[model samples]
Target: MNKNLRQTDQPLRQILTKPEVSSRMTKWAVELAEHDIGYRSRTAIKAQALADFLVEGASLAMTGQDSPPSGERSGEPWILFVDGASSKEGSGAGLLLISPTGEELTYALRFDFPASNTEAGLADSPPDGYNRGQSQERSQLVVLQVRGEYEAKEDVMKKYLAKVREVIALFDIFEIERVSISQNKRADALSKLASSSFAHLSKEVLVEVVKQKSIDQVQVLAIDSSATWMTSLMNFLNSGVLPGDKTEAYRLQFRAAKYAYAGGTLYRRSYLSPWLKCMTPEEGDYVLREVHEGLCAAHVGSRVLAKKCLLLGYYWPSVFQDAAALVQKCRACQVHAPLCHQPARKMVPIHSPWPFAQWGIDLLDPFPRAPGRYEYLEVAIDYFTKWMEAEPLATISGRQFRISSGET
Candidate 1:
């Protein structure tokens, strides 16, 4: 009870149980690390317990006893044990709610079994000669089989009578005689009802949904153990898995230490515990020289080999950019290179005026000739200084091709 509410203020817990108030609370430990003294930073411990229940009012100290119903609150209902293993079969759960300080009550995530007989009522049953009903109409015929034929049993009995009138309008029966119950035990009861049915407004929202499902199951087992540790460090760094005589790079780091001890035993019951034994053998020869020098300069994928194994160090660095863009788009140098086209555009330079300018002529042809001399070769050109002139035409009639276009 927070040490019986700090020993009921025995002179402010003997001046905060002093040694000069623990050396002035260790020289004002970072301005009294205020989680109302329990210590945590980002504020809101339920807005400091509703600012100590609006500056100590609701008849003050309930748990201490301004009014505690003195008995029957019993125990149970602070459950939260989740388990989700996967090498195929693994799922455990058990959850109870109401601890989120019920201001409007809400809790979900349920594999909804016989949840306290669907919250009492006994999950419906009782027809064939209605065993003379009475117990509140057999608990309204188990709330019409706990509204099962898929809801609408008079709209789930008018939404469970409007959640019993919004939980008696935010508590009143003396704050339900200042309710108090606490229990936690797992490893059974389906992981304590899957970690107590899920009611969270704090405990950092159930420890950020169990640290985001343990970072989505350690990012899917660190992407299948980084593709079996980059295919056992590229087949022991390119073909050398203890075949020939002399050993090398310690037989490729003893076959990348048996694929990094079977990918660190599939992330050893992971939450990345013991941080995958910090991978070693000089971090698998610096991730096999950054995936063979990034697949020989420019083609590494698995998100560039998980960003070159986290810039050559790795702390579970997982890129897997859609499995490195499906391995550099199934390379064959990106599926056979050859798809270039862009050539067409030129004209406008008819400037002459003199000095063999503007001239233009062309007629070149002669091959395997001299036997009967019919292959002609006469050329003359000068389109504004691209000058040239030659002749070897013995027959290209039509007046020798109009005197070879007036000899340039």
Candidate 2:
């Protein structure tokens, strides 16, 4: 019996001495000790309490415990931050739409022309959702915050204010609040970034924010079929039929050869020249305004303005007349007209009969002093022969002139 007990004890001792076996037994002993002390139950209870606290905190945050007072909470107002920046490069407007839940949507718009800060601000129209076929009730309360006080004192700003009022009428509740520049820095930064040459915007964000319309998307003007000037040309291009009258028929035939229809637009062809764009009276006027004083205009003269219109491949019967009238009526051109350098009187030619007979003399002084204290030059020129004679003199004496000219 003692030998059998010793054999079992020997096997147990060997198992305890091995590293892997000893580590496994030590882990089980620690787990058993913890279970006996009710540590697992305490840990589970603490975890469940932590989870409840997290769920309660999330619920309170979603319900907005720190929301506005009940009196002002009838309609939750969305905060709108707007700013405009004007610089030599360009003008831009920025707007920030901040939801009640703290989500923000930013937009930056670049103007076609350089504008003043107030004008730039005025250029910003309400977003499509606010302005599009939606009823006033559908429009949410908006709190507009700007950095500067909005005063429509100026005549131009008055028009802008009128537009702003129109936009304001769309909302059921709207309030304009003036904030400090420091508080509106984000909108200001967006405007400045838009005015800069390069924009640091992600492609995905720009795809959602920027709205670009293609040229083909714009509606073209409908030309009247009974229009007097264009009716004959349109008929000739559409159908190769001329009037029965000899004079009208011959005229139509000659003009029809020069005109052709391409993509629904009438174009006049010329020898060794690209087709000229045919425009109606209203279209001609618009072209003149655009080329003469539009965004990239230098406010050129009437003749150059007319030439520019033609060079741009546009043509009309009264193009020169329209361009001249437009330039004459331009307020900016009238106010900033440059001074004319033309002489008041006509220049008359001076005649000389002989070379030596018509000599003109003049004196030049205050030159560097020479060895003989000469500081003046006497210049004589024969007007007829175009010969000149110059001599440095110490003093203006009649004897020196006689001696220099070889006169006794």
Candidate 3:
């Protein structure tokens, strides 16, 4: 018999392996020897099979059979899940962007200003989703109007719709779909977290504060292709061309004298220092961000930061303005700025109707250790009479306190 069959032959197995057997058992053992059977302890086949099955299932779960292959193509679609959350404290949203390669990008947005009907849509639009996403009926998502099923009657919505269309036009392929909130829990949690506080947020999540409405802003054109403030100065140095207007041409001439152009770079003349490199407002803004938020930055005040940049030998017409704007937009500077210690309510002045009518009372201090060992001092001052009285006590008692104040 095979080794597999020998183990299951229980009737023969019982006595086959035993050395000291009775005649009857030995007879049976000898009879079983013809089949080449042997005996060993039985294993729990059912239980072991079950355990192995469970281990295989767990491994399959970890490997994620439903997940798409990592071999990515250039045109693979990106999946973005967004949810908007707002509270009386503030408005914010959460966004989860999943790349085709399975990389997840998480973001929490805090709206700096209070959200209005139109603004609320923008507030939530940062993270809101639909199909598997949104508040469905009452949702103000920008894509909601673009879906064409819903109409945006408000001017702001129209403007937003136009802006959304403009942005979508930039992409070669773009699609919007709805998703239920349950399917987008990560985005929903992020939105709520942003509405509360960012201090307790997870390290993997990025937090951003939106200070202005997107509709109010214009698109930024390329500086090189468009007219810049440096255009006039550049014209005078390169080709000696001036504006037709005498007044403007004269001003341009004066400004051009202070600047020198060579090797395709602009430089400004300085009395005690070497020629300082001149930059456009856009370039200056970048430098300001580096100096104020870079490794060496202490996040100093805007004015101080601008002065430091000047000392570093660079100049721009809107240098100060750019520095101030950058500082104002800095998340760290705004969050950690000096707090006002003043009371929230306005202070009211106490008025006295007449002298000695009523007195203002206060504890002058913890009772001084005087010769009498007074440990508490209760002072009373007449608001109108300007008279004062004080009582010192080594130990305080309700009865003593009333008597000392002449309340009895």
Which candidate has the highest lDDT of all?
3
What is the full ranking by TM-score, best candidate first?
3, 2, 1
How well is each residue in 141-167 modelled by candidate 2, as lDDT tens digits?
Answer: 112212134344676556655655667
Candidate 3 per-residue lDDT over residues 109-134, each given as its tens digit: 87887764344544444232212221
CA lDDT of each prediction against the hidden true structure:
0.40, 0.67, 0.73
* After superposition, candidate 2 runs with Cα above 4 Å error: 1-228, 271-273, 343-408
Model 2: weakest 10-residue lDDT segment is 133-142
Clashes of each: 18, 0, 15
Of 2 and 3, the candidate ahead on TM-score is 3
Instruction: For candidate 2, give the lDDT of residue 381.
Output: 88
How many clashes in candidate 3? 15
Task: Write the residue-wise lDDT of candidate 1 on 108-150 in tens digits.
Answer: 2333332232332221211122111111221233334333433
- Could you tell me which 10 consecutive residues in candidate 1 have the lowest summed lDDT? 174-183
TM-score of each: 0.22, 0.32, 0.37
At residue 306, candidate 2 shows an lDDT of: 90
